[model samples]
Target: MKKYIIAGLLAWLPLAITVWVLRWVINLLESVFDVLVQGAAAILPLSTHDVLHQLVEIPGVGVAILLSLLLLTGIFVTNFVGQWSLRQWDALVSRIPIVKSIYTSVKQVSDTLFSSSGQAFREAVLVPYPHAGSLTIAFVTGRPSGTVAEHLDGEYVSLYVPTTPNPTSGFFLMMRRADVIPLAMSVDEALKYIISMGVVAPTAEGLASAPQTTRPAGL
Candidate 1:
């Protein structure tokens, strides 16, 4: 009975979580749409108030508008004028005291994670963690640089050791390149493994492709 119950839960859990997330997002978008409609009704002529109110009655309008805005913004930013304007905008924001500090930090991290040329979180690796007896999965973010690199004796890479079930919060460590073992699993597969708390594992093909390393004495 317990085994059957567990099996049933495994079948429905993912669907339930997915539905919950979608519902949350739809609710948020609808709320934003309501606000926009209300704001427009307040500023526009009384004649246009009915039209704005009617828009609020339509479902998914907010999501559609949000997507359209994002698409238009992407198109705009690709142009030379838009690029220059973006730089100017960044410069303006960067001059503000506390806001600049927060904005700059987030921007740097976003660029590093999302940029086409950036190496952050590109490869999954296995490394000794907590102790030499234990190994954990980590993502190779990049190499250490600047003053931090000056004190290091050899080539070292920065890694992110994501905790099980919550990849967002993790420990950052710098380890020698020679010590970390590269894995054959893709980032997506690695993430699934981590988020499932090792219940989901890489396929046999992926494990077969991983480079074989000689185990130290008892390990």
Candidate 2:
């Protein structure tokens, strides 16, 4: 009986979690849609107010609209006029005092992480952490630059060592490029492995492809 129960739970748990997440996202989008509809109703004719309210009540409409908007925005941003307009908008935003600092920081980070040509978080590696004897999974963020590079002894690479079960919080370290072992797994697979606390192991192929490493010469 215990074995049967365990098997049933293993089958049901994933599906339950997936559905819960989808429901939460849908609810959030619908709430935003409702707010927008209400604002529109206030300014538009009373005859059209009922139609907007009715549209908001329809299920899945918000998700569809949001998806379409994203698609359109993506299409627009690829053209010449769109690129020019984006630059103009960015220039205006940069002139704002307090808001510019926050916006600029966030925009720089987003661009680095999302840009096709950027190298941040592109490779997963193994590096010694906490102590020389212990090793952990880390992502290669980039190489140290400017004044920071001058203080370092040898060729070094910046790494982000994420904690298990929560990849958002992690340690940042700079280690000799020779000391880190490159893994075959993609960034997404490595993230899943970290978030699962080693429960969801990488494929055998990925494991086989990782190069063996020795302790750094000084360590």
Candidate 3:
């Protein structure tokens, strides 16, 4: 009886969690639209308020409207006028003290991660981290910069060492290029391994072989 119950739970657990999450997200978005409609009601003319409230109550319409706005924004940003406006907005933010610090830092990270030229996590790599005789999975995040490059004599590569179960928060390390062990596996396969805490490692022979490491003597 206990075994049957456990098996039933195991089968339904994923479905239940997925449904819960979807419902929660939908409710959260609906609440935002509800608040907006309330505010519009308070200030808008009677006809406009009625239309806005009716539209807001339509299921899934709020998300569709939000997506349409984002598409329109992207279209606008592709033109010269939008680019100038963006520059002006950026300048205004830069003048603010604390906002500039937070905004610039986040913008830099987002650009690096999402830019077309940026190749961070483009490949799976092996690095002898923490100590020798042990290997760890790392993603190539391009070359080092600034003082880190100067200190390393400009020969090191930047890598993001993702922790198990949570890849969003990870450690950044700069190691000599020679210390990096390039793996044959693709980036997706490596991420799966990390997300599963290594339980879902790829079975391909390419990943099974240990990559050769050729470190520079100075390091």
For each candidate, the alpha-carbon lDDT, in order, equals 0.87, 0.88, 0.82
Runs in model 2 deviating more than 4 A are 38-47, 209-215
TM-score of each: 0.86, 0.89, 0.79
Taking the tens digit of each residue's C-alpha lDDT, what string does model 3 give over 1-219?
999999999899989999999999878877877787788789888879768978986899877766687799988977999989988998999999999999999988887887778886787888887676677889989897776677776378889999879988889998878787778888888988889898897868548534343533332
Write model 2 residue lDDT over 16-94, tens digit each, in one string. 9999999999899888888878888888999998788779878899888877888999889889999999899999999
Order of candidate numbers by TM-score, starting with the best: 2, 1, 3
Which 10-residue span in candidate 2 carries the lowest summed lDDT? 209-218
Global CA lDDT computed for model 2: 0.88
Any idea what lDDT model 3 has?
0.82
lDDT of 3 at 18: 100
Give candidate 3 regions above 4 Å deviation.
24-47, 203-219
Q: Candidates ranked by lDDT, best first?
A: 2, 1, 3
